[model samples]
Target: MSNQQPPRRFTPMSQFATDYPVLLIDSDAPLRELHNCVSERLNAALKYLHLMACTSLPDYAENDINTVTNIARILVQDVSDVFRVIEPRGFETLKSQ
Candidate 1:
């Protein structure tokens, strides 16, 4: 007697979304405007960080620390807004047209 084994076939499951949520971009604003907003906020944060007077750690006062933290918060909000609108690389179709 000869024994023959059957090949198995499998079906793929639907994709599941990641659990993390992002701060949503404003629907009323155009994409160009959103881009400008994100860029400007990031620029503002960088400008404050580059303040020459605060070059050394000892130069930072309590108010300076608060200002730096507030700038960081602004940057986070801007980034979260951006991530809300973009899709994962492989999951999206690449179009050249």
Candidate 2:
């Protein structure tokens, strides 16, 4: 007999959508505070990625490069929302030179 596993079926979120928006609305902190925390972590992750990207190129593979690029794109997209929180909420930003 061959050693292989059967394909697994994917389940849609609609299968568990009975509660809708109200189910997961609870959180320990306010939404704005959560947004700020997420932004800070994303910014730190981007900085870490920058450092890794600057390191020796010979140690990385084609897949590693692609993975890093994709993750950075996602982090940047989420981080942009931080600006929405900061600016409209009257937080200070550094002036560009």
Report, for every candidate in turn, its global Cα lDDT versus the true structure: 0.55, 0.55
In model 2, the clashing pairs are none
List the RMSD of every prediction in angstroms: 12.6, 16.4
Worst 10 residues of 2 by lDDT: 8-17
User: Given candidate 2, what's the lDDT at residue 11?
Assistant: 14
| Alpha carbon lDDT at 66, candidate 1 | 80
Highest TM-score model number: 1
Q: Give TM per candidate.
A: 0.48, 0.46
Assess the local accuracy of residue 90 in candidate 1 as a C-alpha lDDT between 0 and 100.
17
What residue pairs clash in candidate 1, if any at all? none
lDDT of 1 by residue, 1-97 (tens): 7587642222121222445433345444455675677677778767766773467867779897787777677676665555444323212435532
